[model samples]
Target chain A: MHPAISVIFFTVTSGAGFGLMTMIGLGFPMHNGIVAAFLSYLLGGGLAVAGLLSSTFHLGHPERAWRALSQWRSSWLSREGVIAIITLLLFAVYALIWMFTGQRIAPLGWAVAAGSLLTVYATSMIYAQLKTVPNWHSKLTPFCYLAFSIASGLLLAGMIGKATLILGLPTPTIIVIALGIAWIIKSVWWRRADTIGFSQTGSNTGTATGLGHLGKVRLLEKPHSGENYLTHEMVHQIGRKHALKLRAIAYILGGIIPVIMCTFALFITPVFFLLIAAISMIIGLFAERWLFFAEAKHAVSLYY
Target chain B: MTLLPAQTNKKLGLVIDLDVCVGCHACVVNCKEWNTGGYGAPLGDVDAYGDNPSGAWLNRIHTFEVTPDDAPAQIVHFPKSCLHCEDAPCVTVCPTGASYKRSEDGIVLVDESMCIGCSLCAWACPYGAREMDPVENVMKKCTLCVDRIYNDNIPEIDRTPACVRTCPANARHFGDFADPNSNVSTMTRERGGYDLMPEMGTKPVNQYLPPRKKSRPEETTEIAPAFVPKAGEGLLGWLDRALEKLG
Candidate 1:
């Protein structure tokens, strides 16, 4: 559970990107003509591609990443990669048709929408399937991912709409509602995660080492004095006070501030406020994603 | 590929006796030594002699103080490597077909050439058995000394895992667990051997024998002090004074 910056960036950025793509596919903002359609797709596609590429940056051998798609039959990571590639390719084609013909194909749009959402789900499954990390191995993990995607996607779509003036902004009420749902999912996720380590259902040192019958088991000595890959990768710690502060920042910036901004956008400069909300949500989500990895307790850490 | 075979012909794994192991870490060292040259990738070290040394190791020994109720505390030397589980999560989680459990012998291995080094396999493993080799950028793990175990080049007596061959205490044993009469199986049945993290449900092939309870003498024997103070031994050095005060 090291809070790897690359993975954090990848999850948050890609979640937003897929969310935006989902919104585009749903025919929101009513994009027309080459410039509007091109800009919309570029933002969505560019963010998606950039996030995907950043995910590879943490790989020991990024060049070998293509081989990851081969084991989708059993591996969630492979499934995510495969599904993501297909989603992006199909979305690209759909964007191209829209950009050139200026016609929104309902069937293709629906397909892209489903594909985009599925890609997000697959990405979430990559974490959720890890029974080794009890915090992530839950139905709520996928729910949180999907909820965040829709929330961020809706906000980005509204921003794109405002920037292009192709159509009036999406109902601000809807944006606020999406943000509310996302906040609720996130609150539940954080609460569940916080209590999991102390929960009876979670793994512990005694159960991990099969020494519960011995009463209390404590480490007398470690294997080595030096650090190893396990210690470096899985034994991350964050202060409680720091984490609390970050959580507040994440909620306020990622959810509350955006909701407030959306609520007031109609009363003030709608464009400026919507744009601010979009940026704030992303930055806030970045903090939340960082905490997601930092707070997770890997079962392997029990041995250490 | 990543899909595990319905059944393995043999479950070849290790049985570690916590009662006998002295926490010498000889198995850990020998496993790394033999595997560095034998396996898919050389087990490597970064900043080996520098301020902060980090590396990939196949085997690790953890010493834990186990205090049983109504019993004296005992230190248990726990040596952990790959369990080579019947339901190996690491194998199924590998994005490439790099990680696989052999249906023939049930040895889980990483096909280094195919590994993308994405590290999802490591995350899935409850034992922290697989490590990402910083140098090769591929997963490195205990192959259970696959090369030595099956090699004709080595002497018959030496045809086992490097760790087992090198254990001075004879605490480590290697054999097939599938055969009812196998030494490992018999030992497991007799010793009440248990799997680590059974709750994780990996159904690990490896088993660990718990440290046996200590037996105290029926009668306490009080012996005379080793040294009798002489008539004029009033003063001594600071070290002697410190020892006297400790006494």
Candidate 2:
């Protein structure tokens, strides 16, 4: 729950990367020619790899991160790592084939698209599977992650389309709609998150300590005088006012502004508007991802 | 390997009595001392002698004030560590095969060699049982003294968890809960032992017996009368008389 910058960058950037790859694999402006196709792959692959590398910077043992892919049978994180690798490999092959041969193999492209989307799903499950943080342990979490990934990915694709003169008239509408849907999903997620923990029945301190029968159980003394890993990692206390302000910033920058920018780009000075839309969306997502970790209440905090 | 065993032969865990625990922190200290040298990595400290000292500790004693609606408030010294649940979310959540629960004894442990120190397993644990070692950057939790309990080098009587062995108030008990006749199981049944956060569905092997109610001051009988001096009762009375005569 620390809202680590490395993790936030990893999720936001990688989600966008995978999302972009999915769009490219599905032939979203990638059929425009060699330069456009190559540029699309480069941007998508760069973002994906950069995000992946950023994730490793937070690891205590980055060299041993390979071991994480072994337990895909149970662990969601393992599944995410394994799927991400497979997706990257497939995306590379698909992009190379398109760039060199200028021929889009239908089956291979579909496989790349599927792989990219599945990677995003696996990434979402990394947080959604955690019952300890009730805010994330919901069906809506995956929905929220996928929506954001797709929307951000579309924004990037729209930018590429405008620059390449391959901008389909309906593409802007689609991107705007995607952005709106992403915000709607996030709004629902925030609504549920606002009432997820402690307030929920059977998820409070009394239930956690098994002392409801005795009435109120209050912490008299903490286990340690100083901050331990648990307090440091799990006990993030974000004020409601600060959180509201961030949410507003996220909505205005990530949601409303992008929608307005995408709509304007459909007619007037298209390239600049699309680029601004994409950049604003990423910044907005960073804020959103930060709140995703900060607002979460781990069940272990009940003891403290 | 992170997958839990379908059934464990022995559910080895602890039973802490809140009534008996005096919050001495002896168990907490002994656990740290023994674990630092006995198993995996030495429990490391950061800024230990400096301002904002923090460290990884396997066991900790939390003091809580319980206020019942019908009774006065009372303090309970709660010593918490790994519960080693039958359905351990921590083990399953481990991306590497680093975290696992033994089928033989049901004690959950981390294989530090394989740990990436992602700290996901710690997040999975609802009891705040796991701690990340600052130096080794690996996950650490109570091993239930797996090194001591089976060590032929140590005396049989001392073959228990360091915390249970060092508890001065006799509040901590360790044994296989799978056996119905075991001391822990019997104590649990007789004393109304219960799990922490049963709704979490962890089905923890460890249990805690609630503190017994305290007797109110008015309910206690006053037996001894106020002191009154008798003339020839004893040396004290004679001295008092002699002093009076002199006066």
Candidate 3:
């Protein structure tokens, strides 16, 4: 799947945004609960909008994205678009109601939080439904997306904590714990994906020739003169050694470093550790997201 | 208008006999000939005589040789194309309503005009059935010759798919899968047909019957004809025989 940079950014940014919003909406009443609650809405709302806007750049016709929301009944992509927009609307309404009434609207916030989570589920299902691509079809993929979002969201919340002195000790602790748990889930997901063998032969040169008898097949002949659409779209040749190095970098920088920094910050200066953790997570997740796309093998590659 | 009653028609499909296929490629040529001139748009080919030659082909034949244990080698000819699966992943993944499965006949089709050329449907297909039409920049696949199958101008007997009509071996058969009494369904039931990559669970409408096996004859040794000695050779042999008797 020639992991387009635009899509990579879209998933990570939007995933983090949605993840953060759901967590904040759920944990609104923790410390300086009112102010923390408001901040959560603001930060989560802003990031979600930013992610959606960035995703539009990938579309050839951004105007057509509007029509995408109409087919939620059948299409997961359409459902995702619809769910995302609805999440935003619900969050806004929840915020407005809270601001005007001063007292918390528990039912409304809970409903909006549920909607935000559904948006994430829909986003994950878009990839999971594709049975041809073994890598994306796993049940773990959606869970991984959900976990990564929450972890990224927690890291974001911790960063927010540093800027403003809200609920002192317990707040940062909770965020760090969430980040740690997310890190573990991602690690397990990576390991599981490694164990499963690809169902389809990555190259289709032999399959096309109808010689399944041949145990091993190499590129015996070039199918065409110049690059065809199949070759360009499917046979993305990212070096194996380079991918291994990138995975290490993603794990250390995106996973380990943030966890350590966040954990350390809980005891030491909350602001210092929080800032480092937040920055590390943002950078790490971007690398992780890039690898997620780069490493994924589309079944169409069999043709090449 | 609720003028006509909702008639439940079973989706028709093809069950190719791989064992019987002769790899003649009659189906491929016939399909190209039928599709190019019949449909909404011609299956365009760029640079037919120039350096690079490429065009849309609905059916392709691939020949393979399989060697079984304690048996002579077997040649299997497979005709490759869309299986038209019941649970088509291609339809679900399309962001636009462009790709859809018809409830009336269960044929998975792409609305070329509505397609945004995202290539998601192509990625979703396991069989590599969907090909991007570079000219139109939209996905293309076997429409089962929909435009020709029901044409009133064509005779009822001749209205079958071009590929089915052209197959000299009669390896290809097409009929409504809903009717168990149909020729294709009965043949499949009797022969115990199988779908390609059943593990994927696409529930492909097209089934492939295993190639029939042939028995081998027993091996035997060959013997040379009896020989007779010439006059000179016989005399030399007699002298040698006398010498041997004397010794």
Candidate 4:
């Protein structure tokens, strides 16, 4: 499971984007009292769309992304796409309601907010349901995705607050607290993942014959000479030590630095801490996402 | 209009017995034969009689020598292919709706026409089951011989998969795993079947029974040397003395 940068960026960016949108939708009632409701809706909606556009670049065929919605009966990926579209529609309706009424519509706002969270769940289940990838098959995956969305959302919200000069400093302070908690959950997941050993017989080379033997199984002969589709797709890998260092970098930049800066902002001015946390989170999560892919041991890699 | 119902009650899978599989590669040969001729495209072999002969195969047999720390080693043959997992990664990772798992029966399959050949499904699969049909430029895998299994035109007994049908030793079984009383399920339970790479947690439906251990062979006693050299051979002793002087 060599984690491709494209997917890592897609997950983290889209996750944060969805989180921010949901928060804005949930907090729309507060928007009318503190700031221009239209402005909040526009900004939140725009950011969510932008994040989704960024994620589309990772797809091999973005045009076909629409067809992905058709298989909701069986595929989680399809469900995620379908839910994302539904969330967007709900958000749009919620915005129109807020603009005309000059107040948050309780049912619409809550529904959209819930839908946004469901989008995150669908995204997380895409990985969590995989039984072969031990690192992903755990309760922590969905929890981590949800927390990561919240953490990223808070960072974005805090920045928006600073830029708008709304809600004073307390808004960013609360966001920082949320980010800190998210970081702790991610750290625990990382520790737990490290302790689990992979089953030896699962390797493609070993299991291809269905022998549970513990003896050394090397690629005595490849089934193909040139790179077949399986070899090309599954055998891609990076060294283990490189992935370890990258994981450390991701933890520090994506997890630790954002927490520290957000905490500092709780007592200090919101502007400085918000900017630092947002930037650090984007960078750190990129690394974290990359490590997620790179450190993954695909059962297919056994053939190599 | 042919309505391939969106779902069906076919839990198609392979049941491989670890005890009997001798790593003969008969399954691999038969699988290639049946699938290449019957399906979307032929499993192309680039250099058949030349330097290299490589082609796509739904099933591959692997041989390994298993040795416990304190026990003697034994050869075990493992036949590897798609497990048709309940929670298949290949289905989720497909950007296009080409790869899908059947809700009716837990068969993870790909629609060749819908597939853009992105190869992401291959990356998602821990088992090296899915392969690109070079001729069709679409993803391909063992279908459990979907067309063959359900065809009423064929005799009921011959309706089984090509590989299962061809197995001389009856090493492979095909059935609806959803039914608890199914032969495959009962056999698996009674034999204490194990999934390949259970840690991956893909929840593959196919299970492999571990090889049954055989009793140890009788130990042979060590025999002493047949003949002792009498005071070193007379000629050899003289040569040794001469060689020592020369040194």
* Model 2: per-residue Cα lDDT over A1-304, one tens digit each: 7888998999999989988988877777644577877888888988988898898888878899999999999998999889889888888888778878888777887787788788889888888888789888899998998999999888888787643333544677888888889888999989999877655436777777676688799999998888899988998785333898899999998998998998898788767998899899899999999999988888889888
Between 3 and 4, whose lDDT is larger?
A: 4
The parts of candidate 4 lying over 4 Å away from their true place are A28-43, A50-62, A96-107, A162-169, A199-239, A259-273, A299-304, B1-37, B41-57, B69-72, B84-108, B114-126, B131-139, B147-247
Model 1 chain A poorest ten-residue lDDT run: A162-171
Model 1 bad stretches (over 4 Å):
A162-170, A198-202, A238-241, B217-247
What fraction of the true interface contacts does model 3 reproduce? 0.18
C-alpha TM-scores of all predictions: 0.92, 0.93, 0.76, 0.71
**Local error of candidate 3 at residue B146 (angstroms):** 0.7
Evaluated at residue B53, the lDDT of candidate 2 is 95
lDDT of 1 by residue, A1-304 (tens): 8887888899888988999999888888555889999898988888888899999999999999999999999988898888889889888899989989988787888888888899899999999998888789889999999999999988888776743323344466788888999889889988888778725345688987788788789888889997788987887775233788899999999988999898887577776888999999999998899888888888878887
List of chain B TM-scores, one per candidate: 0.87, 0.88, 0.82, 0.82
Higher-ranked by TM-score: 2 or 4: 2
Judge the docking of candidate 1 as incorrect, acceptable, medium or high: medium
For model 4, what is the alpha-carbon lDDT of residue A25? 63
* Cα shift from native, residue A248, model 1 (Å): 0.8
Per model, kept true contacts as a fraction are: 0.91, 0.83, 0.18, 0.25
RMSD of each: 6.8, 4.0, 7.9, 9.1
Model 4 DockQ class = incorrect
Residue-by-residue lDDT tens digits, candidate 4, A38-128 = 6666666665666666656655455555766676766677678888888889888877777777767777877877888898898888877
Q: Give the DockQ-based CAPRI class for model 3.
A: incorrect
Candidate 3 residue pairs in clash (backbone atoms < 3 Å): A204-A302
